[model samples]
Target: MKYQFPENFWWGSAASGPQTEGAADVDGRKPSIWDYWYEIEPGRFFNGVGPKNTSNFYYQYKEDIALMKETGHNSFRTSIQWSRLIPDGIGEVNPKAVEFYNNVIDEMLKQGVEPFMNLYHFDMPLSMQEKGGFESREVIEAYVTFAETCFKLFGDRVKYWFTFNEPIVPVEAGYLYDMHYPNVVDFKRAAQVAFGTTLAHAKAVKAYHALNLDGKIGIILNLTPSYPRSQNPADLRAAHIADLFFNRSFLDPVTRGEFPSDLVEILRERDFLPNYEPEDLEIIKENTVDILGVNYYQPRRVKAKENMPHPDAPFMPEHLFDNYEMPFRKMNPYRGWEIYEQAIYDIAINLRDNYGNIPFFISENGMGVEGEERYRNSDGFIEDTYRIEFIESHLKWLHKAIAEGANCHGYHLWTFMDCWSWANAYKNRYGFVEVNLDENYKRTVKASGKWFKTLTSQNGF
Candidate 1:
């Protein structure tokens, strides 16, 4: 094979609890922020569909895992819902949730698939959210407890664990912007939320290490390389600041065990410092992730801002930089995100050169195209030629990175099947298997799925 991956490289896809599991009101599962937000305003969701109207993984996990095997998934990643596991996110463990999760794990293992479990995936229990979610110390403690419970319960069977998936999304969506629940546009609150989540991650890693479980714990971070529009000093500075806020804020503290000094200085100057205890810094410093999960989808290209922000306006990350769109750049027009496959290689090199060459994987990377159904071919499967090309291009760059000594171990797509997103709902589909919502959520393997089977069977394309 011209492009073969390392032996034992992970091959599969990822999906979160809230996005895939549809039993929003069953089996001792309480309301997550998504569920509660949907109840309050259903129209905010796509076609008025809520989390309850997902792919129904709660009932069809067995069938889905079988499909995963058929699609050449030697390993798979999914999150155990905090609300389902602990109805209140803090107290007694639900026996039903334990049974359900154990069954899922066993089934995957039975089908020769390694189960990678993530503790949290942006599904904060409403009870916890009522108490300020990640913005409050109480919530942070509750999250740490949740992580510990998961470790104690499933650590033996599930050897791979992640504390959180894209923890920065909540900071950006809920605190910085109004895309998610408890939407408050406050930079100070965003900082606090981000700080608390990272601390929670470190605390969870500490707890996992205490258990001495034969597993690795880490965090999934979306690393979008910040590209400057020009070589000008101001433009470079703008990109640097953007990276500081979005990438280094979580990457440094989680992996390097320290927040970026440049970012801390800016936060201090603006009085936007998070309310962190002195001991919390020590916890973060002492406990860093064992592995890293890099999720790359798009790059952030920015130019220096042409106009200064008005003093009266609320603080925003974009105030310092203007988004730049390079001419002749490939684009994912369906999602309105640029498609720069080379950014994946850059991320691998950056991690290898600067982050101690830590073992990592492509945790979440896939193309989300709208109107995928229109591509259904004579074989009754979506052709998805573009999706196949997207994966192949990214994998080519990934192979190049691996050849150069990047310690990336695997490539998992964004999802196992198309499922609900937070606000976008089912607007964009990113899956190897196309899920038919109208036909009792029937699963059909797309052309990409067939290609992936061959890729994994041969260890690469």
Candidate 2:
């Protein structure tokens, strides 16, 4: 093997409860924001599909865990839906949800696949959202309670626990971009949501540690390395601001226990800083993460702003920089994302050199194809050679990074099977296993799945 990993490296994939478990309103599971959003605006979803139209993981987890073993999984990560675990997001635990999660965790352990459980995956319970989601400090306390409940219930067997997955997504998508539910476009409000989320994360971390559990807790952040279009001072400044806003905003608080001073100055200058109690800073500073999960998909290529928004326009991150589209850059046509394989290495080196070489992993990385069914061969398997090449190229860069002493320990794909993606629904398939939704959510290992099995068996290609 040309690229062998360290012993006991985690080899698996990740999916979320809202995307995989289809019982949106069954077995005492209440509506999440996804469910509410779909109810009000069904057309917003792809092909009119909603949260209930998922892969049926709630009933098929046993079969899915067996599939994980077949695909060479030594570990797998999935989230516990807050609405399901505590139907209203606070107060009495749902017995059915408990039984379901307990069964899922035990089944994974029985099948030799370690479960890496995340507490939140962009699924805010509707009840919690009604009380202002992360914007309200009260909701933050509620979230802490939910986190503590999960820790008490399943923390014993699930050694890897994450407080939130891509915590910045809700701030950006729901508050600033209007891409998610409770859509609002206010930078000030977005900042508040972001700050509240970080506080919630820190509080949860503090709560977890107070229990003296024998496990690691962390947060999964989707890190996009920012690159300036040129060495010009203006371009460099633009790139720096972009990095500070997108990456360092959460990264610094979680890892370094402080926000970047420059980010603070920028927000302060605009009077956009979120309201924070004096003691909140103490909690944040005292409760940094134990591990980190890096979800790398693309890098941000930025340049100095070519055109500024009108004075009346609402303030936004783009006011500081413009996205640069390099000529002839590699592209994932299906997903409309730049396919920059080297960014993975850039992230590794950044963490290694700047972040004390903290132990981390590629928590979510994979390609999503628009029409994967077109690649199905006569043998009844999707010939997903592109996906295989995609993972291998990134893994080679990761291998080089590891050889250079990066603290990365694992590489889990974005998912283990084709699952529903919010809004996008199942339009882009991103699973090692091909799920035929037309055939009652049937599962078949794709060509990439077979290749992945071999890669894991050899520990590399």
Candidate 3:
């Protein structure tokens, strides 16, 4: 039951700009899509706690980097708000935003904690969304410009760069599901948005390598392994379809420089294929990532849809494949996601063999538990045994994958400080360090925090 990581393995945590930074309208920072969406649809978020009231890490990053070091992080991944850099998403670089980010990045370097910075994480400058967000090819060009600016500004010191974080989710939540901003349920627009994003990522990667930046660049994708109900051919094929849409849609394009034939065929069959140019394929092929970040939280258990709806029903992803809960599968009640640790190994090995063994990291994986305070002891520590088990179980599998020649270099959990989820808000906590919501930002290291420190120091739990 014991496991050890490679001697130089990276132990860290990951967070996004909008998720943690709270000064929504300060320091010459313009509103992002999250801020704009919350103002109009306050009811959309859980408990009405929008992006403005997260962890206050914007002003407390120095204190936070200290906490990261304390939690055994030699490296930490966070993002720079694009709106802060370009208030209008096009021209006029904001000096205050630059100054604030310089301070944060410098502080991270000072503490010997490598800062893996991402350019965008579901937070588009509100100005760009007005011009049709990813729908407009003009928006794609603007993103490349913003990306180049970031590299010129921070590429000297910060090495690790991610172009986007889970790009597919927005296309689903915003365009298809109506759960995120610019909510619209249209397949055509969703397909267009997804293609634009793929092109945008390729363009950014192209730009990064042109600048000849100091470090590696990659995309952070949420790759959930899809499982079939049984060996039945129908169930197996259904799982394959789900994986193509959710996992390979972005994965294949970015890592392999080509989209899957199965997915393209589906889109073609339904007349949902997005517009594409000949030059785009060359860009994607030439500018593939030097690294990858795989965010695995749970596995998808799928079965064929029980009933075929009328062909006219609005097409959602769920229409393609139905979710069926296995009678005996383990579950995380608070989070509503299944627990399948071995899937991590499956992901690692699959990438190794299929994606040419690109260097990768566990980008985002965590347990979100409600009312975590109940476990806090009088001595000011939370006995998060569940978190420890969840992590160890996954690592056991990850170790096996590494031994089998998977090119995994690191593991960064969902977050360091307790923060707000888009819809869940602060209702569920996933931080190793707990943040006090009622009072000033006071942080206490939970049992998981202490446990992680030990794991990193010893290179194992």
Candidate 4:
């Protein structure tokens, strides 16, 4: 059987500034929280490898853009580091950053690949962090100003704009899980950060609309479908609550113009509600996203908790439900993430049924593998047959959802080339083209890269 994608599909991958563009202290680029954190606690990062050791996209974007064209990329996504653009987070803009971004955008356009620009991707400026990051309303105002600056400068060429990539990550990592910067385990602070992030998103959207730019503005949310462990009512309720906290927490406000009332009630009942101004609610209600970007890598399988959390312990979402690892579920052994391809179709159907079928694309979806170098063939290319299979499985399900009237526009891989991750560094590679850091940052087209080229050129497998 043959499966074909829609015409003019956005066939490419997503990358970020901090993860890819490694000129940490150059070109008047001030420190982001990652840089500052790495400076303070070098041992926190994987193998003591920091953000400065990235793919060097800042210097290699032209070559990378050429590779994007080689891989049959009709469109590509990357973020502009806020700290690099406005070094102090507000007021004076850096001309070098503007020149670099303009060159990158123009180069992509020249190569016949459309540029999809995102404003933020977990890189908070050090100045913003000093002002309390997303937990402070002052930082939110500053973020809105930054967004407006992006619009005024580059919105003319970049048609697809995303306010943030995986906005829930900071709330989970920084506030609740202690995995990211300013690591803390406070439920109230998590809720406050989440609310402020969404409010800032809405304010950015409002600012974009006010300018009446030709481009469309939206957000990239990593939506992990919550699956119940059993058919019991308690299990179902547990899944529902998990969905509310993880998925609908951002989805509802961006797509439907309001937060889930049930979620709010639970927060209020627990006295964990975030501080909010009356005008913030109106701002969220008035400015919803014009489109959405969904990043699906895994599903959350949860079962109702049999024991309640200790009153003395700090509050966390996991206290309400226990994660269930199915005995026979397929898994990505390298990353320890469940491989559930059907979740892609489920997400599409969800959007069609509940989100006015608003136009969207798969912003990030791919398999990550550790020690991918072992798969390198004698021909100097990595034979990533597993990645090819992984992508095809998901694409088939995505195709089914689109056939069933889901308004999905296209699919973009998690990344273009192997790049540095926050704490993980470059341990796991999730790229069609493998980056050989030891060999002068050489870019080699993997077997999956060749396969993707064919897939994009043919519109499908």
Candidate 5:
């Protein structure tokens, strides 16, 4: 009936700058990658809604913070838009953008909600992309300058800082897959992007620590635990490979400061390795994060590939593994993701045993539904008992992990308020409070929001 976290545990939700801020062009804020991508391919976004129609947190941050206090947030996670700060990516810090963030930080501090800020999410300044996004080492230098600026500007009051949020997603989406902007399908380019991102993360960390700011800085990684299809050795090996690629690709370097030898061997075997100077390894080795933020959504159900692809079919991850859904795996009818509660504990235990028990927190986790408002009653509140159940299920495992001496410190949901997703737009609302776009951003706390308030107040549901 009750479980109490450590006293003063962080209690809030995670949000990104592009998803919340709506002042896309005003006050010297230039267009980010999302803005440029949506412009070039208007049909790529959902409901034809672009970044400008985001939750409009730029204008409603005051009211939103009051609502966060009302719903029992002691701390919150949000990202600073890279383009908003440095319109051309590195030069000229926008004064209006600084004022906007200063107001946000002051508001959060006034409401007793410690602000956890991340330097970059998926949004890259379009101008930077024009000059060769993550591939160009010059862009890496630009990122260093931008990260340093953020530390100097906001590091005084903000104690928790993140260098990047889910860096792999952008690499995969933009370089390998075609879902994100600057879409390219070259495996060599993908390798380059991945390597460059790791370097950029280290450079940012190096810069932040050099400032001697009084705070902790880390990176947010989405670690998808891998499960094999069967007990067969081949399936087990396949699952291990999947884990190495999806989880350890970023994890091994960030936490352990070295790439997994097995992964390196595989890359070398396929001739897909990136050009790495010896110093690149040194950068990763010395710049391990102060903390870690693990975002676990679902487990990766994998089996060995049924058949090999042609010689030139390209080196995709799933080429070595196949997603195999177990017959009895629990599924969310409203969504496609498998709902395995134990994965949360498994993730915590993995971090404890292998990652040196680094202090960490859950940066994002939530269920997305196509039509959440269908369950609303006459009072205009969604009966999101499903969301409450989802949180409780994960928390029970988290509480057990903490009691067992895992170094997990806190938990944050996917979002605080509904915001526009990439191509999904507002179709998938994963928030404790729902925002009505038609009503000019009117917010209504869902049933899950009320339950979360009580859970935070009591330290459990």
Candidate 6:
């Protein structure tokens, strides 16, 4: 094989309980923020579809695990919905939820697929949100308790654990942009939420280690490399600030146990620093991650701010940098996201040189097409040659990075099957297996799925 990966490299895909498991209100599973938000404002989601109409993994884990093996997945990543497990967020456990997750894990093991369990994936219980979500120190402690409970319940069988997936997303989506629940658009509150989430992650890491479990615990971060349009000092500075806000804010603390000094100084100068006890800093400093999960989709093309906002306007990251559209850049026509394969290699090199060469993997990387059925052939399988090309191009760069000693361990696509995304809600299809929504959500392996099985069997393409 020309593009060979390391031996025993993890080849799988990732999904989340809230996104895949469809029993939103069944078996003691309470409403998550996604459910509550959809209830009040269904029009915000695509086609007015809500969280209730997911892929139904809750009722079909056995079949799903079988499909996972058929698609050549040696390992898989999925999150444990906090709302489903605890329901009330900080009290008695849900027996049904425990049984459901236990069965899912056991079935994966039975099928020879390793399970990489993540504790949280943007699925906050409604009760926790009512208590100020991650913004409140009380809620942070509650999240830690939930993490500890998960460890006690499922630690022995699950060898890979993650504290959170894309911890910065809620801070940006919910607090800054109003894309998620509680829709607050205050920069100060967003800063508080981000800080509190880091504190919660540290507490969870502390709790996991205190139990002396044999598993590795880490946090998944979506690290978009910031590329300046021009190397001018101003443009470079703008890119630096963008990186500080989006990437380094979570990456540095989880790996290095501290925030970037430049970011801290900038926030301090603006009087936008989040409220934190002195002890909180100690916890963050003491407990860092054991590994890392990097989810790279594209690079950020930025330039210096062209026109300043009104002096009295609310603060935002855009005030310091402006997004620049690089001419002739590759893009995913359906999703409107840039297709930058080399960004994966850039991220690996950055981690190798700057972040202490910590072991990491591509936790989430895949294309989301708007209408994939158009590519279906007469034989019923979607050809999806573009999807295969997308993965192949990215893997070539990843192979180069690993050959140069980048310390990358695995590559897991963003999803295993076509799942119901949060707000997009199946607007884009991104899976090797097609989920026929019109046909009782039937599962059919696509052309790319067959190709993947061969790739995994050979350990390369």
lDDT of 2 by residue, 160-215 (tens): 99999999999999999989988899999999999999999999999999999999
Residue-by-residue lDDT tens digits, candidate 5, 61-127: 9999998988888889999998999999988999999999999999999999999999888999999
**Local distance difference test values of all predictions, in order:** 0.93, 0.94, 0.90, 0.94, 0.89, 0.93
Give the runs in model 3 whose Cα sits over 4 Å from its true position.
none
Q: What ranges in model 6 sit over 4 Å off?
A: none
Better of 2 and 3 by TM-score: 2
Instruction: For each candidate, give its TM-score against the true structure.
Output: 0.99, 0.99, 0.98, 0.99, 0.98, 0.99
User: Model 1, range 1-461, lDDT digits (tens) per residue?
Assistant: 48989999999999998899888899889999988999998887878878885998989999999999999999999999999999998889999999999999999999999999998888999999999998888999999899999999999999999999999999999988888888899999999999999999999999999999999999999999999999999999999999999899999999899999999998999999988789999999999999999999999999999899899888998988999989999999989999999999999999999999999999999999999989999989999999889999999999999999999999999989999988788999999988999899999999999999999999987
lDDT order of candidates, best first? 4, 2, 6, 1, 3, 5
Better of 2 and 5 by lDDT: 2
TM-score of 6: 0.99
Q: How well does candidate 4 match the true structure, expressed as C-alpha RMSD?
A: 0.7
**lDDT per residue (tens digit) for residues 200-294 in model 4:** 99999999999988989999999999999999999999999999999999999998889999999999999999989899999999999988999
User: Residue by residue across 206-235, what tens digits does model 3's lDDT show?
Assistant: 899999877989999999988999989989
Candidate 1: regions farther than 4 A off: none
Clashing pairs in 4: none
Cα deviation of 369 in candidate 3 (Å)? 0.4
* Candidate 2's TM-score: 0.99
Give the clashing pairs for model 1: none
Please report, as a residue range, the 10-residue window in candidate 4 with the lowest summed lDDT. 52-61
Residue 71 alpha-carbon offset, candidate 4, angstroms: 0.5
Better of 3 and 4 by lDDT: 4
Give lDDT tens digits, candidate 6, residues 287-330: 99999999988899999999998899788999999999999999
